[model samples]
Target: MAIQSSKTVSACLQWVIIPTGSHICMAEFFKTSVTWVVDFHYEGRPRRWFKAFGPHDDPFQQMTDTLKDLYGDRAKLASVRKATDEEELQYLRGEEPKNSYCPTGR
Candidate 1:
């Protein structure tokens, strides 16, 4: 059931059609979520930000979709992964370097 639901979520993130009878998973069922630090270069300058990945979400694709909008087709992705505890803390404390970082509470 989880696998099927994951497929559904993946399809949804990609805007792909999921055939009938596919299971859908709710975000509540996911107990472990991660805060990703997305670093990239958009239009020749570095852009950094945080994005949360919930249980029903596809992390990489979400970043791709989001960065695409801001960075355009030529955006260069530097890295995308779970944020460290220190990184998260710095962000919460408003100490992160000036960038596109937007603080959304975990």
Candidate 2:
């Protein structure tokens, strides 16, 4: 009876269906209530940043070189992992640094 009544009352809601891909995977599902947001984060730092040599001494490579030149071995030519946000904040705030030769924190 409820199903019959529901069929009698037509809903004016609009729906869109796009079947472009071969298999329909629900991996990116987040729209049951209408707010769309997608931000991807890596569990570890990108492997490209850890390389000893990068893209022919370009900006990233040059920056790494500059740090090594300025701070030597303490400047992290090869880091075990990405610095956490809090650690980076401490560096910016002069709360702590691995090396004392980096001039005044201000």
The best candidate in terms of TM-score? 1
CA lDDT of each prediction against the hidden true structure: 0.68, 0.35
After the best TM-score superposition of candidate 1, give how far the Cα of residue 50 lies from its true spot, in angstroms: 1.3
Candidate 1 is scored at a TM of: 0.56
Give one digit per residue, the lDDT tens place, for model 2 in 6-75: 3334476333344544323332231111211111112222221221222222444555566567656554
* Per-prediction TM-score to the true structure, in the order listed: 0.56, 0.25
On the 0 to 100 scale, the lDDT of residue 96 in model 1 is 69
**lDDT tens digits, residues 1-106, model 1?**
2222344455447444454433333344334667779887776777777766786677778788877886578787788888999987887687767744434321
Error of 1 at 76 (Å): 2.4
RMSD of 2: 15.9
Tell me the deviation in Å of residue 90 in model 1.
1.1
